[model samples]
Target: MKEMCPNCKSNFAAKDINNINKNSIFIEKQCPSCNKWFCLNKTLTIIKIIGIFLLLITSLLNIFNIKSEYSPVFSSIGLVGILMAIIVTFFGKHETVK
Candidate 1:
């Protein structure tokens, strides 16, 4: 991804390493040209979805191997998670704060 500095309007390559959150919860970067800051929330990651269901919940729904009576419900939730991730990753807006 390329981010443009709001001050200088110069584009720069985006890297996860540029994030500055001490707890590693956000993606933060500063423009090399103007030294301005930008940040994006890390809520769109598919890994977070996987962590919630497959890893943390230890559910078979992740692998499409659900055999329980709640299989349909679990499947729906998984599909929603995938859709949300894709939309957030591509079309989500950026926010800046002090």
Candidate 2:
């Protein structure tokens, strides 16, 4: 599990627990935005997964033309939806809080 740093709010990826127990569950992560260290949280990972899944479903529905309406408007809407999903899925990373 990751926790966001209460100070700078930077996102730090946590490595699976190994032999090293730092006595603290968290590590100091450098914030790309503010250059400060903060705790990372596992919630971010969950959110990213859910967002991508929804994006994939919408994109597939658009690709197969599953809907009965195959009009130009429908096609355009589908294309736009797919594009938006891709963008959000790939680049919707949360920025470090400053």
Candidate 3:
């Protein structure tokens, strides 16, 4: 499914949205049709940030050779977080630019 522009109320594919900066989530996007700026909703932004943080923590644990019985649990959580962040990128709701 495509995302709807909050301003023009027009539907757009994920590829149609342009990020102000490819590497930064803090930037807003412009609607191709309306030319109005928008951004991912606060809830999704938080989820994405948390997911990235979890992944970073797990990566650090591995890099430091921290081994424990809960290692598998941490790894799984990290995997889930990665997946969640990716999902939020495409499916997250958009709001006016923050």
Question: All candidates' TM-scores?
Answer: 0.57, 0.33, 0.75
Regions of model 1 farther than 4 Å from truth: 6-9, 15-22, 41-67
Worst 10 residues of 1 by lDDT: 50-59
Query: In lDDT terms, how accurate is model 3?
Result: 0.82
Candidate 2 per-residue C-alpha lDDT over 1-98 given as tens digits, one digit per residue, 9 for 90 to 100 = 44333555544444522222234433334544455544334354455445556556656666787664644555555556556545544454433323
In model 2, pairs of residues that clash are 2-40, 2-41, 3-39, 3-40, 3-41, 4-39, 5-39
Model 1: which residue pairs collide? none
Tens-digit lDDT string for candidate 3 (7-40): 7889888688774654665557788887888778
Deviation of model 3 at 4, angstroms: 3.3
Best by lDDT: 3
Candidate 1 residues 1-98, lDDT tens each?
A: 76655556677776622545545455666766666665554454434455345332324654656567776676676666566656666565545435
- What RMSD does model 3 have? 2.8
Q: Predictions ranked by TM-score, top down?
A: 3, 1, 2
Q: Any runs in candidate 2 off by more than 4 Å, and if so which?
A: 1-40, 68-98
lDDT of each: 0.57, 0.48, 0.82
lDDT, residue 71, model 1: 68
Q: Which ten residues in a row have the lowest lDDT in candidate 2?
A: 16-25
